[model samples]
Target chain A: MSGTFIGMPAFSPPTLPAFSPPTLPAFPTAAKEAVRNPTLRRNLRYATHTIRAKRAAAVSELDDWAALREAGRQIKDHTLRHLDRYLLQLEESVTAAGGVVHWAADADEANRIVTGLVKATGESEVVKVKSMATQEIGLNEALAAEGIHAYETDLAELIVQLGRDRPSHILVPAIHRNRGEIRDIFTHEMSEWGRPAPEGLSDTPAELAEAARLHLREKFLRAKVGISGANFMVAETGTLAVFESEGNGRMCLTLPETLISVVGIEKLVPTWRDLEVFLQTLPRSSTAERMNPYTSMWTGTTDDDGPRTFHLVLLDNGRTDTLADRVGRQALRCIRCSACLNVCPVYERAGGHAYGSVYPGPIGAILSPQLRGTASDIDASLPYASSLCGACYEVCPVAIDIPEVLVHLRERVVEGGPAVRQGAKVTLRPARGHAAERAAMRAARWTFRHPGALRAGQRLASGTRRLVPRTLPGPGRAWSATRDLPKLPPEPFREWWRRTHRPGGQAPADRQEDQR
Target chain B: MSSRDVILGRVRRALADVPDDDTPYEVAVQRGYRRAHGERSIGETVDLLAENLADYRALVHRTDAARLPGLLARLLAGRGARSVLVPPGLPADWLAGELPTRVADDAELTPHQLDRVDSVITGCAVAIAETGTIVLDAGPDQGRRRITLVPDHHICVVRVPGQVVSSVPEALGRLDPARPLTWISGPSATSDIELDRVEGVHGPRTLEVVLTSED
Candidate 1:
């Protein structure tokens, strides 16, 4: 692996853009809103279950899938450990291949770099392939601010852009909206963007697809610049790869005079050899295909073949901070297959919109906070969005332990310490919400550590079990109201164990591991 | 900052933090990962592919070359397809028999015209038996990428034993890595949120594989 090269711009502090999208409700509120939409829930339930079954069947066919998953995990972990070396190698190789490599520290910096690149092209409008990295940095918004327009070429993405909607799923950005809603979005909004919907555009799949195809066809042929994200970056060869079901990506990549790819640094694999694992895992895990229909790979620019000028923006945006933590770094292993999202029960119910990022689902629960930080109310609320059912873990092609990371992030949030800023190592001040929980936990921790105090406290609690309120007071009341607090036994387990076993008699088998 | 610069900076910093030694890459083990996690071998990998293909509702056939052309013609005839779209560079012998078909050149046809074609036939670049994937580059025989997309039925020919690979690393060695590669395991399909499986949302609806073994 190589390290970062290209004289890329650094991220300045994030400036809250004037035109922020509808503020994502705090997790509970958004989730509640999502649950009430019966049509959306039905769509989610149907889609997730069917994909889950196919994925299980597909995975069951591979006796070595477990091994493949482990290999993917290990390779990613190893790469992340020495990410700098690989990034440099990547930069040198890409540059040597006639591709310019740019470095972006955060979303703002990344957007600025991309906007500047477009401005330099002297093109006010660019065609875009569905890229998560670009969305993360709010590049489209930034470009618009600089008087540049980005036309989305992907069908679902076109629907999203036309409707002025935020993507709710990684693979299917418009997964939250149904066919009827899509028909309305296209018919009412398509003309404003470019071509209008055909006369009598119905809610049928064919009509909707036709409307989008016509809408995007114009953008693909006329655009002078293309923007994209890669599925994988081969470090040794400096090749960038994109896998898609539609042929739209191929057009955007090949048609434009100048092509810009803004990729997350974690997208790299050491060699083209590493691509095999992801190519297989990505299609199968995401769309439940043995392989994707279109897997487009380009190395810099080719002579009279594709784009003449190729630029790669390798983005960090809190990735380095994410990589520093041993346990949390497992997130980089994600191939963005969306298998975890398909199998995620919470995602099926609450929908992707509730997660409040372009990523959505289980992967988003852990990834967004680490990358964006748990500073804002929405970011802090993401970790608690899961039921920890581990469906996401079971389906992950790259085997990201999403629940583990969610719990880890939750612990960080509840620690009530100062926030961890981008590129900085120090912890900032306690977030207001977690202060009470942190104090309570600290007192409980001190009590648990002292055995004498623990046993006495347990007895007191058991005797007063009836007096305990069914619902907790203050912030906790909402939680206990919906859930049944475990009833206290007649006696604490410690007392029961002591009475059953003689003191110093091997300390009882159940407690042996704890003692060790 | 451009999106490129934002991403590149982070990648630069990430690369800067890791040590320069090649030990990490060198010690990156693939075998132990499989051993500790995967218990199967290459033969089992082949079996997985066959089984998974069948599970996806795709028709899988094992045939010798002498029997392949006849078998494929029969399969097409059964589907009531009058003419099949043949890639310009497809092996002549694959369709040597007397079957009436209109060959579609990937280079000349538009998306609207290709959609009207009944079936498409081409040789695969590589077949990952472990994942049951069929890759096609616009190599000499594969033709343009759109032919595979517009048609509802795709009959991909795979020369078994020769083209098969047990792992992704093995497949990567055979590919150009920079070419426009199309990987197919089965027909293109998607599910609604209600868990209803719908095939042919974008690509071909039915996929048929004729595994030819001349050895």
Candidate 2:
């Protein structure tokens, strides 16, 4: 638990690290307001339906999509298992190729490393691609604290940054904003950032696109430093690949003099050969295309083409911990296709903002809690966000069993005390409420093991069936308010079976032949 | 510390714990890239290139060297494309009596000028079957990458059977890693957060393939 301890700013208390008890706007209230916005709902419905349909069609074209998904999952799992080895391989390969690599254990170290890198460059401004890793680390805000500016080049990301609004979706960050809202944000906010929007700018797609293009063009041309997060990293040759529809990612990757990529250690695949699976699954899964439009790949740096210097920061904030959990480790296999998000009923209604992290929707629910640790109200609340509908697991390109993981984490949250931060097996303590649940489970376990005790308990419960209340009287009342509590049977199945056919409680399979 | 040293230091430290033994590349990773990427066998790879090209709303046709000129004439006459843009190294007979052909001299014309032409046809460097991918290396017949990108329609003629590979590794082995390789999968597309899809955002909306097999 005690490593370097370098300037790790705690969020609230002395012990808690920065954003440990991660702060979020009261989501229940915000989501209530969001649901009421008719224009937003219309925009979301139109957008999600369109993408979902295209994804389905694109996915359908492949006869072995299921096998492909399994292969993607297996590859990711294998990589995560040997992450330390692959990371070292990537580092050696990159260094040999003249590229630099940095290790960041947590958010503070990551931000400091990147900010220091930019400071060394002597540039106060950097053009950035739409990178979820940067948002996760709050890198832009960290840079802003030091008076450095980070310009967002992606069109959707630009809208979110300009409006000072959080991204509400993964694939399309500005999915929450309508055409009219975007036009207003552009016209009013564009000048402060760079180029001003034209007078009387309309809400048309053409005009809004032009305004964003004009606004970002200058940054792309003049910026000396560029930052990005790669979709995948090749360990064999130390290459990184970024898939983008717009040419903005390509420009940011190529135009700058010094390029810094903050990549998740989980992003590495063993070789370029492994990249093929994702190259196929990722595009069709996320953008619903047979393939991505612009796929820019660079192996370290080269002379007279692309960036002269390249630095890749491999981040493992909580990936190792996540990878240790056998059942929950599959969450790291996510390719960020956002197909699960698109199909999620909860995300569709609540939007991405309510989840309160860079990653939103069903994947976010499981991933956030595991990565950040289930310490805060937000992390605790995220596990319960899903309906356990299993749609996410169904549509996921990697076939991660999201519903199963959600349930497992819920049990861990409800039944155990905080685990030792650095331990082999999470040790459990008997807290009061958890003790009650544990006692009940233990009693049930004992009764099931002993037939005599089981019979007595069943008969006792069956006798009191009429006295059972339809709803609980206290805390359970609140839980039952939104759901139906199952009613007790007049007679236990054991008793019914005993009286009708198996009088001595002999095996039912033996009685079946006698009855015939 | 020197800039190179600083960067390399961080890399070394991060990778400090990795084991010395180098495990073979992840098998599943290679399988992922190869499967459903383009086509399986050489025959299927050619078929996939044809079908995918058609699926991208590209026109496709099959012909032999003996009938190549006649097929070209029929295609050009069918479209009534008065003229076509040909790359500098494109075989003369490929367009023999096809149309009034114009050679694409990269030094003389810009992308804007290339956009004015009705069609630009070239041969691909290699075609991947699993992802329906075609690689362009800016070779003599392939012209500049921008030329293919800017034009309205592209007729890419792939030599059937031989130019196809089942996996990206096979394709990568044949490719010169230093060359500028442009991998084309399908028509360009983008999606909004709500998942609305829009095609032809940047690249061509239509792709055409003419699979020429000697056998």
Candidate 3:
């Protein structure tokens, strides 16, 4: 490859706005750009397509998949319904087992709790398993401010870290990068970290994995502090389960003496037997396997086995607020399988970065707005980021009715209603730019209710059809900008229906032929 | 207010929609999924376990209990393993002294020291047939979790027909939830690179499962 395209921004650190959401543009703007990048689209298409087929086949192996999906849904619903009791039970069980449990209502509190715990350990660096909870809290960023370097051991996460880029996909964070791009990131970025990549690394996957293995081996060997997030936290047994395809999680979880898992409160299930349902579904939904290569489950500190000092941080951030909304609480049931993302048409073309949150795709469309609320442009627009295809709900292991929630959130955004923010209730105003669309919807609702007036209007429009322009003007220009308007029919369909279908009225020629 | 109280209060309030009647755990979830995928004879279950274990790239070997020691010796000699880490409760005859020098599991065996050992031999608490998973619960024969983890290779001897279960639910039934459970399907593998699976990351890259059927 020539040096002509060396400055391609795909591998560079994100140029997003300075502060947290400061630089995140609206979903449409980011998605538009992602749609234009052929490389990103190609990467997303290939990865998503490969996983999607595998997931379908894996799921088909189970004779009772639908039953299992329903069971999963009920179990999560039951857990959420009794979250207060289960959380307390979990805390009690874990504490009884000699593990400390801390609670944080928001990201800052969560980060502070984790940082203080790490400081107590006196470890300057930590190895981390790939967790959406930590990413949501920006724990690494928070720890970095205190002069701590957190090493991400998951191979995709390492690439994102080395490239100094944001994670683009939930599972495969660097899904936007091709093999050649990954090779370049390793060649250029490995030296600054721990171990340098061997000279003249090729684009082969085995070579790339070996480079990451060798590079991260030093970190896993000596690292005293490891951070992770749990896939499921069993309430009755006080067990925390982490399912992973790689052994890196095992290294971080097993090798480290001090392991801190920042788990969301919603991760709890009522009992260990509940795992039977999820373990079967999570692997199939995620990696499309009967089981991931390694699944680590620990309840507090083991005598001579895993982490000696285990701290379970229960992180809320906005989960409580999301849980408050009756319809929106279902987002908490997600297993982070990324099944919805793989099946999402919008996600396939626009990619994950557009969601402007750690979560992306159909789940993100509903989740980001609820977790962060719809006050911002990107968060508000996320509710409108789909074609309502229902592909997401079909593949969701817990059968979260994502389309139902998307429409509900859209109504919340455009109609501006009551919502819970942080921990308090707040009223949201209908976002400013949606006035025209809202007014059009209201007018359509009014006309449909008053049929006589609608017929009169249709007749008037037909009479004046000659004067009507094919293109809309004013507020309607945005709609017509990317699409052509269909021509007005000679007569309204209702009038033709009246002529053809009414018993007293003469049958149309087509109807007469059918009668004959 | 403390973050803990605030979160608990929030959780209580968020769950206000549920009815007052406390639901029992067994009834809340419908466990319609099978304990095992389908009916299989004891011999078939062991065969399925072996088949699934090899599918994930774990090396599967079969031999009668009488010949297991000789087989283990030949296998280690084949690898030229100079040192093998032996758990305290591993059957003494299983090693046969001809394989390599035995580094016994001890309180002083640091991870770095274990790393120097070429292989680890341990017994599994349970093995699942459908998923091809060997669960190590840090039992006497299994030693600590780290012995199997730090070494480059692991040779887990599973007593066929006795230790094998047909499914995950069946396997979990036999395992104590309190103990630290590491359910390993194969050698530590990762799909992190380009979402394509490549085996042999941090965990034992080579996992040799010996299915010893007592004749």
Best by lDDT: 3
Between candidates 2 and 3, the lDDT winner? 3
Each prediction's DockQ?
0.26, 0.17, 0.74
Number of backbone collisions per candidate: 50, 20, 1
Q: Please write out the lDDT profile of model 3 over residues A1-516, one tens digit for every residue.
A: 122232212222332221255457888898999999999999989889888998999999888899899999999998888888899999999998879999998899999999999999997779999999999989888887786678889989889888988887888889889899999999997876768899999998888888988898878878899999999999898999999866888889988889999999999998888888888999999988888998999998887777889999999999999999999999999989999999999999999888898898999999989999888889989988999999999999999999999999999999998888887878989998799999999999999999999999998887787889767888888678778787666667787688778998865767544333
Q: Who is ahead in TM-score, 1 or 3?
A: 3
TM-score for chain A, candidates 1 onward in order:
0.88, 0.86, 0.92
True contacts kept of each: 0.35, 0.21, 0.70
Q: Which ten residues in a row have the lowest lDDT in candidate 3 chain B?
A: B14-23
- Candidate 2 stretches with Cα past 4 Å from truth are A1-21, A25-42, A198-207, A417-469, A489-516, B1-170, B176-189, B199-215
True contacts kept of 3: 0.70
Name the better of 1 and 2 by lDDT: 1
* CA deviation > 4 Å runs, candidate 3: A1-19, A449-452, A466-471, A482-484, A494-516
Clash-forming residue pairs, model 3: A17-A23
For the predicted complex of model 3, DockQ is 0.74
What CAPRI class is candidate 3?
Answer: medium
lDDT comparing candidate 1 with the true structure: 0.74
- Give residue B193's lDDT in candidate 2 (0 to 100): 28
Relative to the true structure, candidate 3 reaches a TM of 0.94
> Residue B205 lDDT in model 2?
48
